[model samples]
Target chain A: MMKISMPRWFYQLASPRWFYNFTSKLLPWFGIATLVFLCVGLVWGLVFAPADYQQGNSFRIIYIHVPSSILAQSCYMLMAVAGAIGLIWKMKMAHIIAQACAPIGASIAVMSLATGAIWGKPTWGAWWVWDARLTAMLVLLFLYIGVIALHAAFENKAGADKASAILSLVGLVNIPIIKYSVEWWNTLHQSATFTVTEKPAMPPEMWIPLLIMVLGFYCFFAVILMGRARVELLEREKRSDWVKQLILVNWTQ
Target chain B: MSFFLAALKRELLLVFRHRSDIINPLAFFLMVAVLFPLGVSPDPSFLSEVASGVIWVAALLACLLSVDGIFRSDYQDGSLEQMLISAEPLWMLVTAKVITHWLVSGFFLALISPLVAMMFFLPEPAYPALIISLLLGTPTLSLMGAIGSALTVGLRKGGVLISLLVLPLYIPVLIFGAGTVQAGAMGLPIQGYLALLAAILVFSLMLAPIAIVAALKISIRS
Candidate 1:
C-alpha cells in the first residue's frame, strides 16, 4: 500500500505526549468557554425565549432537549471519525479520544431522551411514543451501550479499542438507514404519530436562543472530550517519561 | 470463487460435526414464536394482527442465537487466526462464513416461517410475502450479525454481547420484513416493502463483510 504523506502537525497531534501538552494548555480556555456559553444559553433559552403557542411553558424544555439531541448525534459522528483515524494511523491518541467519546456520547444521548420525554408529557400527552425521531434516538442509545459494553468486555486494551472503533464506524453507516427506516415505519403506523409538535416556523426570538444553546452544548462537549482524553492518555501512557514527569510535577505542586 | 466455496464448505462441515448448530436456532425460533402467542392472547384475530412482527422478531433472535458461533468454534480451535494470516483474502473467507451462517439460521428460518405464520393465523395471501421477505431479509441479518460475532468471538460470553451489538443494527430489516408481510396481509402491494428489504440486503452485503474482517482481526489480535 502506498503511504500518503501527512503534514508534520498531523503526526504531532497523533503523539500522546504532544496531545497531553497541547490539551493541558487548551483545556482551561475550553472550560471557560463552556461555562460562559452554557450559563448564558440556558438563561436566555429557558427564561427569555418565547414559548410555543400550543404547548406554552412545557415547550421550553427544547432549550436543553434540542441541543442535547443534536450534540448526541454529533458525538457519535466524532467518535466514529476518531475511530476511523485511529485505525488508519494506529494512533494511540486517536483511540483514546474515541474511547473517551463513548461514555460522554452515551450520557448525552440519555440526556436528550430524558428531556424529550419530559417535553413529550405536556406536548404529546404521553411519556413515550414510538415516534420516528424518538425511536431512532432510542436505537442510538443502544448502539452506544453496545460500544461501551464491547470495550469493557475486552481484557486487552488494544483489542477493546479496535473492536469498539469498528463497531462505532459500522454504526455510523447504519444510523441513517435506521433513522430512515424508523421514519418510514412511523408513517406506516400513523395512528400514534403527532402533528401538533410541528411549528410553522421558529421566530428568530425562539431560534436565536436555540442556536446559542447548540453552541454551548458543542463547547461543553469539546471540554469534556478533551478532559477525558487527557486522563485516558495519561492512564494508558503512564510508563512514558513525559506522563511520569507531568504526574511528578503535578503531584509535587 | 473456488476458494470461497472451499472455505464455505469447511464451515458447513464444521457445523455438521456438531449438528445442534443447525437445529438449535430453528428449535429456538419455534419456541420463541410459540411463546409470543402464549404470552399474548392466542385469539386468532389478535395473533393475526401481530403475527408478522412476531415472526420477524423471533427469526431475528434465532439468527442472533447462532451468529456468535460463526467465529467462536474457529477462534477456539485456532483456525480463525490461521485464516486471518492466510494468503487468501480474509473478506472472501468471511463472506463465505457468513453465508453458511445464513444457511444454517436464516435460510431455515425462512423455510419454517410460514408454519409459524399459520399458527398465528396469518392470512393466506401473505404466505408468499412472508417467505420472500424472509429470504431477502435474512441474509442482511446474517451479514450484520457477522460483524458482531467477529467482534466478540474471543469473549467467554460472546452470545449476549453479540445481541447487544447486532440487534440494534437489525431494526431496519425487521421493520421492512414485517411490513412486507403486513402489507400482503392487508391486500396491499408488497413490492415497496420487498424492495426496501432487498435494498437493505444489498447495502449490508456490500459493507458488512468489510466490518467483519476488521473486527475479526481486532478480536484475534487481542
Candidate 2:
C-alpha cells in the first residue's frame, strides 16, 4: 500500500492553533485595508460621485446597499463551502469558520435589507414593495435566520456543525433558484421599478466608487470573520495549553 | 428490493395505526382554508380571486405540519438506530420513509385539496389544475421536509425549527403550484407551471433522500 503525503501547509492550515496564529498576522492588514477602502469609497461615493440623472442623490444608498447584499450572498456561499470542507475532512477549524460566519452573514443581510428599505422610501415612494429583489433579500434573511437558529438549537457542538452544514448546503441549492424565480416573477408582474443593476452602463465616476465599496465590504467581511473565528477557536480550545498560555500572556501584558 | 418493500410496509403500518396522525394535517388544511374566507371576504368573486393561493398556502402548511413526525418516532423508539446500523443503504430506507410520508401527508393533502378548494370557491376549470399541481408539488414538499425532519429529529422542540428550515425551500414549489391554478383560473395554458412543478418534484425526489440520510446519521449519532 502506498501512503499519500499531503503538503505541510495543508496540515498546518487544518490546525486551529496554526490558523489562529496565521490569521493574527493577517488580521491587521485586513483591518487597515477595510478602513482605508471604506473611508475612501464612502467619501467618493457620497460627495464626489456623479448623481443619477433620474433619482438624483438618493441613488447614493447603492454604495452601501449593493455591496452589503453582495457580501450577504457571498458570505453564505463561503459558510457553506467551509461546512462542506468540515464535513468531508472532519476539520474542526473549518466548522469553526462556518459557525462564525452565520451571525456575520445574518447581520450583513439585515444591513442590506435596511439600506434597501431606506433607499426605497425616497425613490419608490413606499417603504416596501414585493419587488423581486427585495423579496429575494427578505427570503435570504429568513434562510440566514434558519441556519442561525438551527445551530443554536443543538447542545452538542459537533451535531450543530453537521446539522447547520446540511442546512446551508440545502440553502445554497435554493439561492440560485430563488434568484431566478424572483427575477422571473418581477418580469411577469412588470413592476418596472428602478433597479440598481438595470442601467446599461455607468460612467467611471459612478461605478468606480461602487467598485471600491464592494472591495471594502469584502475586506470588512474578512476582518469580522477572522475575528469571530478566532474567538470561537479560543472558546472551543479553552482547556488546551496554547489557549491557556495565550490568555496568561495577554493578562501579563 | 424486498428490504425496501418491508421498510415501506413497516412505515405504512405505523402510520395507519395512528389514524389521527394522518387526519390532523388534512383537517388543518380544511380549517386553514376556512379561515381565509372569513378573514378576507365572503364574496365568491373575492374568494375566487384568492382561491388558488389560499389552497396552496394551506396545503404547504399542512405538509409542513405533518413532516416533523416522519423521523421523530423512529428516532425516539430506537428503530432509526437499528436501521442506520444495518447493511442496507441508508438512502434506500430514507426514500421508503419519504414515500410513505408523502402517501400519508402529501398524497392525502392533494386528494382532499379539491374539497378544501371548494371552500375558497375555486372555479371549475381550475379544479383539475389545482389537483394536478398539488399532486405534483406535494411530493417535493414531503421530500424536502424529510430533510428538515431528519436534521432536527433528535431535538426536543423540533416542530417550529422544522418549519423555519423548510419554508424558504418551499417557496419555489408554492410559486409554481399556485401559479398553475391561477393560470388555469385566468383561462391561460398552465402546462408551463405544471411542468415546472413536476421538474421540482423529480429533482427533489432524486436528491433529497441523500440529504435526509446524511442528516439522519448526524442527528442519530449525536
Candidate 3:
C-alpha cells in the first residue's frame, strides 16, 4: 500500500508542465459549474429568498457579502500558505500562485467591504463603522494591496517574492487577532455565528443559497486563477523547451 | 547589550546630525493636528473632546512620515550593507535602529505633545495620559514602521507606499492609544487601557524584530 501511494505521489504532478495540463483540464469544468451555480444561487437569493422583517429588501446583499467576505479571508490564507510552501521548498511556481492570488483576493475584499457597507446603511444607520470585523476586513484588503504593490515595486522578481512572502506571514498573525478582537476588546462589533454550539441565525432556506454562492465563488476563483497563472507561465517560461513543444507542437497537431 | 547601545548611539547621532530633516516630520504633525480643528469645528468643547484623537492621529501620521528615513538613510549610504555583514545578528541591529527611531520620533512626539495638546484645548487633567499614551504607543509605531520601511526600502516612491502599507497595521495601536485618553475623559480607571497599550507594545516588540530583519533580507536581496 505504501509503495502504491509513493509511486502516485512521485509522479510528475509537481512539475509545471503536469500542473498546467491538469489545471487546463479542470478549468472548463469549474467555469461551467461556477456559472451554473452562480445563476441558480443569485436567482434563488435575490428572488426566491424571503426578505428580512428588519432589513427589508436590503438583506439580499448578504448573499454577495457573506460569500465574498469568506472568500476574502480564505484567499489570503491560501496565498500565505502558498508563500510558505515557496519559502520552504524554493518552488517558483508556488510563488507565482501566491502572486496570482493577490489581485483576486483584493477584489473579493473590496466586494465584501462594498456589500457590507451597503447592507450596513439600512441596518446600522451609517455607511461606515469602526467595528472590529469591518475594520479587520478593510485591513485585509490593504494587506492584499500591499503585497501586490510590493511585488510590482521591486525590479528583481525573486526579491519581491521573498519580501511579499514575509509580509503575508506577518499579516497572517493578525487573522486570529481580527477574529477575536471584538471579543477581546470592548468594541462595537457583533459576535461570531456558525459556531458548533448554536444553529445558524438564518433558516436553511436562506443559508442554502449562501453555501451555494460560496461554492460558486470558489469555482470562479479557480477559473480565473488558472487563466492568469497560464498567462504568467507562458511569459516566464517562454524559452523553455517544454512550453515551446506544448504550444508549437499542439498548435500544429 | 553593548552592541544594542552602540547601535542606538550611532543611529541617534546620524539622525541628529541631520537636524533640519528631523524637524520636517514634527512640523507635518503640528500642521495636520491643527488642520483637523480648523476643518471640523472651532467649538472649545468639541475641540477639547476630539483633541486626544486629533493629536494621536497626527502623531501616528508623523511617525509614519519619518519611517522611510529610518532605514533609507543607512541603506542608501551602504551602512546597512556593512551592518548586515557584521558579526552581530541582523535582528539586533534592526531592533536597535527601531529603538533609536522611536527615541527620535516617538519620544520627541511625546515631549512636544503637551504643547500641542494645549493648542487643541485638551483638558488639564487629561494631559498626563495623552503624553503617556504617545510615549507608550510611539515605540510600537516605530517597530511596525520598521517593517514597512524594510519592505519598501529600495522601491521608488516608497514614502507613500510605506504609509499605505503601514497604516492598516497601525490600527490596533491607534485604537488603544485613543482609548487611553477617552478613558481618562470619562473619569474611568485608565490602567486597563494603558495595560492594553502596553500589551500591544510588548507584542510588537516580540514580533517586529524578526519581521524587520526578514524584510531587510528581501530588500537587500535586489
Candidate 4:
C-alpha cells in the first residue's frame, strides 16, 4: 500500500471506521433537523403558502417535486464524485458511499417524476409531457437504474463497485448533454406552452416554504445517506477487527 | 501509429473470418426497420413522416447489438487481459477496436441506409441527410456503446442490461440523427442538426475511448 503523503482529512475521510464514528455523532443532529424542517416545511407550504393565482391548491406539489428533483440530481453528482475518489484512491469507504447513493437517488428520481405527473394534471391539463425537464428526469431515473443494475450484475463487491463507478462517471458526463438535447427536441416538436422549469417571480409567501422544503430535503438526504453508508461500511468491514469488536459491544449491550 | 494499424488489421481480419459477426446485426437492423412498417403502418405518408426516426432508432439498436462484438470475444478468450497488460497504450488499442466497430456497424449501416430510406418512401433529398446523420451519429453510438460493452464484458448475460446502461447515453445521438433526417424530409435546413451531430461525434470520440479503456480495465481487474 503506497499512499502518497496526503492531508490528514483525506486519509480520515478514507477510513470506514472514522467515517462511521464521525457520522454517528452527526446523524442525531441531521435526523432532528430533518424531522423539524420537514414537518415545519410541509405544514408551512401546505397551509400557510398562498395558492397559485391560476391553479389554486394544485401547485402545492411543487414542495415535493422541486425538492426531490434537486436532491436527485445532487445525489447523482455526489455519487459520481465519490466514485471518482474511490477509483482513484482505492478507498472502500468512497465506494460504499457511491453504492449507497444509487438506490436512494433512483427512489428520489421516481418521487420527483411521480410528483411532477401529479402536478401536471392540474397545471398542464395532462398527466405527462415530453417537456425537456420531464424527459431529463425520466432519463435520470434510467441512469440511476443502470448503475444499480450494473452493481447487482457483478458477483464480487469490489468489481461491482468499480463497474458501477465507471457507469456513474459516464452518466455524470452525459446528464447535461441529455438535458440539452431533450430540451432541443422538445422545443422542436412539442410546442410546449407551459414550461415547468420557469421559476416565475414568486412572492416570499410562496417561495419561503419552498426554500424550507428544499433545506429539509437536503437534511433528510444526508441523514439517510449517512445511515446507509454506515450500514454498508459495517457489512463490508465485518471481517475487520474493529467492526467485530463494535458488533460484539453492541450485542453485549 | 503502427500499433493502431496493426490492431485495426487484426480486428478487421477477425471480423472478416467470422462473417456472421458482421451480418447478424445488419440482419437485425433490417429486421428492426421492417418492424416499423409492419408494426406501425405501411401508409407511405405516415411511414415517410416517421422514416428518419424509425431508421435512426433501428440503427441505434443495431449498433448496440454489435457493441459486444467490440470486446466480448477478446474478453472471453482473455486477449482483453493481455491487451490491458500490454506495453502499448490501452487507448490506442481500444481506439483501433472502436474504429473497426464503426466500420462494421456504422459505416455499412450508413451505406445501406438509403435502401431502408427508399423502402420507407423517404424523399430523395433526405437520403443524403439520413446517410450523413447515420454516418456521423452511429460512430458516437458505437463509441458510447463500447463503454457499456467494456463495463459488462465480465457479465455472463449482459444483453438487456447493456441496453439499459447504454441507451440513455445514446439519446443525444438519436435525437440529432433522427432530427437531421426529419429536417431533410421536410425540406428544412439540416445543417444545424448535422453540425450538432458532428460536434457530438467529436466530443464522444475524444472521451468514449478513455471511458471504454477504464471500463475494460475495471471489468478485467474484477
Q: By lDDT, who's the top model here?
A: 4
> For each candidate, what's the DockQ?
0.94, 0.85, 0.49, 0.92
Let me know the TM-score candidate 2 reaches against the reference structure: 0.96
- Candidate 2 is graded, for docking, as high
Clashing pairs in 2: none
* Off by more than 4 A, model 2: A1-8, A187-200
Q: Tens digits of per-residue lDDT for model 2 on A13-38?
A: 88989999999999999999999999
Ten residues in a row with the worst lDDT in model 2 chain A?
A: A187-196
Q: What is the lDDT of candidate 1?
A: 0.89
- Name the DockQ score for candidate 3: 0.49
Which runs in model 4 stand beyond 4 Å of their true positions?
A: A1-7, A187-200
**Each candidate: how many clashes?**
0, 0, 0, 0
- Indicate the residue-level lDDT of B38 in model 1: 87
Quote each prediction's TM-score: 0.95, 0.96, 0.92, 0.96
The C-alpha stretches of model 3 lying farther than 4 A from their native spots are A1-14, A124-126, A178-193
What number of backbone clashes does candidate 4 have, counting pairs of residues 3 or more apart or in separate chains? 0
Give me the displacement of residue B65 in model 1, in angstroms: 0.3
Interface RMSD of each: 0.5, 0.7, 1.7, 0.7
Tell me candidate 1's fraction of native contacts, as a decimal between 0 and 1. Answer: 1.00
Q: Give the deviation of candidate 3 from the true structure as CA RMSD.
A: 3.3
CAPRI-style docking class of model 3 based on DockQ: medium
